[model samples]
Target: MKVDLFDFDLPQELIALRPVSPRDSARMLVACGDEPFADKSVSDLPSLLQPGDVLVFNDTRVIPAQLDGRRGEAKIGATLHKRIDLRRWQAFVRNAKRLKIGNVVEFPAQVRALAETRHEDGSFTLKFEGEEPVELLLERAGRMPLPPYIAGKRPTDERDKSDYQTIFAREDGAVAAPTAALHFTPQLLEALSERGVQRETLTLHVGAGTFLPVKADDTDDHQMHAEWGRIEPETADRLNAARRNGNRVIAVGTTSLRLLESAADEDGIIQPFADDTSIFITPGHRFRAVDGLMTNFHLPKSTLMMLVSALMGRERMQEAYAHAIAQKYRFYSYGDSSLLIP
Candidate 1:
């Protein structure tokens, strides 16, 4: 399908600059099967889901992956995309024309990295120059990698150190937060538990690629960037058992949804997985693992929009988005969320 088919006009003022206080206070748009769209709140999620339904969350923590550096007189900006190894990371760089293989970019706090190689797509392989762990280096010199839509409007601050990370954040690697999970809080978790809504976690290090727009004219031409994810055998087994017991497996975000789909077989049984997944979900795609999804409002003509459109029909999502816009709900990474059930 033409990428233009997914395009929608969004008012610039709707882009969220920060999250709502208490996290769970953000508005939620509920789209269930053929039901009329219902405006709700994140705190009301427990009432929306059934007792046995499982909400799979992406526990991958957002690393302070955005870096500002200089090579000679030229300023360079880097956002770590993926871990190539313990010391080396694949990153998207700004001011690439000033960089070359073997040049070291000097960052704040004496943190530096050598430009080892440049990938075809204009990203660079940056190898940190120190015996200390790269995580420590980032803590000293890096900023949280906020999506450009938000960062373009304001600077990242100390508040983002906590705001951009979810309560479930533990295994650190992701450059971008699984924004949908940003609405979760301890109180909300307690309510969900009391309501008998089961929760599970998996890791999918959401990369900066999630913020990239679809430059392709057609869906077939778009190539999704691979992100590392893991699903243990025990978790997979438990999820399968839930489905067997007639319980629904609802992914809490597209990151979890994609990872689940990547691990599922033709029979819809989720298998243990630990690898990079570049699954590009579009309309007409068959969803095997997840019964529903909870995610943030996406950009126009974005791959995420295409993924949601696949879950709900294209026309249904288009109408839903129209309703969301009309209802004055926030948009983007720090924005409101939607519960999509098909």
Candidate 2:
């Protein structure tokens, strides 16, 4: 399909600059089957589903991956995309014309990295120059990698350090937050628990690529960036058992949904997986693992929009987005939420 088919005009003022005071206070647009769209609150999620239904969350923590540094007189900006190894990371560099292989970029707090190699897509492999762990180096010199849509409007601050991350954040590596889970809070979790909603976790280090727009004219030409994820055997067994017991396995974010789909076999049985997945979900794709999804409003003509359109039909999602816009709900990473059940 033409990428233009997914395009929609969104008012700039509707884009969210920050989340609501209480995380669960954000508005949620519920789309279930052929039912009329229901406007609700994130706190009301427990009442939206049955007791046995499961909600899978991404526990990958957002690392301080945005770096501003200099190589000689030229200023270089780097957003770490993926972990290549213990000391080396693949990053998207801003001042690429000024950088070359073997040059060291000097960062704040004396943290420095050598530009080891440039990939085919113009990204660079930066190897940190120290015996200390790279995580420590990042803590000293890096800033949270906020999506450009939000960062362009205002600067990232201390508040965003907590706002951008979910309560389930633990295993650290992601450059981008799984924004859907950002609405979750301890109180909300307690309510869901009392309501008997099963919760599970997996890791998918959401990369900077999630913020990239679809430059392809057609969906067939778009290539998704690979992100590392893991699913243990016990988790897979439980998910399968839930499906066997006629329970719905609803993913809390596209990150979790993609990983679940990646782990599922043709028969829809999820297997233990620990690897990179570049699954590009489009309209005609068959969803094997997940029964529903909870995610944030996405950018126009983005791969995420395409993914959601795949779950719901294209026309239905188009209508749903229209409804969201008309209702004046927030948009983007820090925006309101949506519960999509097909």
Whole-model Cα lDDT of every candidate shown, in order? 0.96, 0.96
RMSD of each: 0.6, 0.5
Tens digits of per-residue lDDT, candidate 2, 155-185, equal: 9999999999999999999999999999999
lDDT of 1 by residue, 18-62 (tens): 999989999999999999999999999999999999999999999
> What's the lDDT for residue 16 in model 1?
96
Count clashes in each candidate, considering only residues at least 3 apart in sequence or on different chains. 0, 0
How much is 223 displaced in model 2, in angstroms?
A: 1.2
